[model samples]
Target: MTELLLVATGLRKSYGQTAALDNADFSIRPGEVVAVMGPSGSGKSTLLHCLAGIVRPDGGQVRYRHRELSEMSDAERSALRRDEFGFVFQFGQLVPELTCVENVALPLRLNGVKRKEAERRATEWLDRLEVTEVSAKRPGEVSGGQGQRVAVARALVTGPRVVFADEPTGALDSLNGERVMELLTAAARDTRAAVVLVTHEARVAAYSDREVVVRDGRARDLEHAA
Candidate 1:
């Protein structure tokens, strides 16, 4: 049986009278990539935020491995977010002061791994992503695509069961965006991580195992490759 990495149902969020999410239900199975598609103001970002536990829903439950994310204490949720879930935002939020390898290793070090071990593992993954050439370069020294590739490495370095990405390629040109998405799809498959990618482009969604259309604050049943 496929394991469920995330489960959410009846997720609702509103700002005064504006409903950002209305009766949203989501389930992500292990090692699967689920793409969310919606036009602007469709609450795609809100849905990703809620699943990431960065935002609390006005009404709903979020489960990660059967543990109620909504019920966890702030510290617990933070730990869960840090350890079990990884995230890549539209911008490559790498620390400009840190080298690529250092940025990738920062999370592991923060989670209490030894510096030597973290760097070793970070280097290994960077090598896999073909970014080891710039492992010593600061974010400012690298190209935008390379920076995003590093972000992908950082997100997966800890082996999180699921990774949340919002508009991951929105800042890039078509070629670069396609390359970044390729790395994401390949890395997720290689690591067995469930990836939840939020994008407006149908082409980007095509790389996912399934596409879930979110509109008017709700989602349609997932569509798979024909």
Candidate 2:
């Protein structure tokens, strides 16, 4: 049986009068790729944020390996995010002043890895992602696709248990988007890491092992839908 890596139960969140997530429950197993899909304002991103500890839910429990996130101190949660959870957002989010390898090495450096060793590992990941030629360039110096590839390398450099990707391909053309998703999913499988992917595109969600649809702040597994 596949082991469950994370679980969120009865999650509820809101921003004033706007409800972002409502009684949403979700789970991820090791090495599984689960896509969260919905229309704009459907709470897909909110759900991802809540599960990742980036945003605390108004009410609910997010558990990583049976440890409740709500019960953890802010510092503990921050540490968990830095050490165990990797994130890829719509934008590449690489530092403009940093080179590709340096951007990839940031997570490792944060976790106390020596700069030389971190860059070595970062180089390996850049090669794996087919972006080694751009390793010396800063984010602005690279194309959107190349920058996103660097972002993926950075997310995987720490060998995180779970990767939270929100619209990871939203800023690219369809071709680049597909390539990015392929690389992202392949890397996650190679590392035995689970992925919580947020996307509204059916093509993007097709790469997932399963899909969940969010509507009116509630989430329902597409496979279980009647």
Q: How big is the positional error of residue 115 in model 2, measured in Å on the Cα after superposition?
A: 0.9
Q: List, residue by residue over 65-112, the lDDT tens digit for candidate 1.
A: 988888899999899889989999888499999999999999999999
| Model 1 ranges off by over 4 Å | 222-226
Error of 1 at 169 (Å): 0.7
lDDT of each: 0.90, 0.93
Candidate 2 regions with alpha-carbon error over 4 angstroms: 222-226
Per-residue lDDT value at 89 in model 2: 93
In model 1, the Cα lDDT at residue 194 comes to: 97
lDDT of 2: 0.93
Residue-level error in angstroms, candidate 2, position 48: 0.4
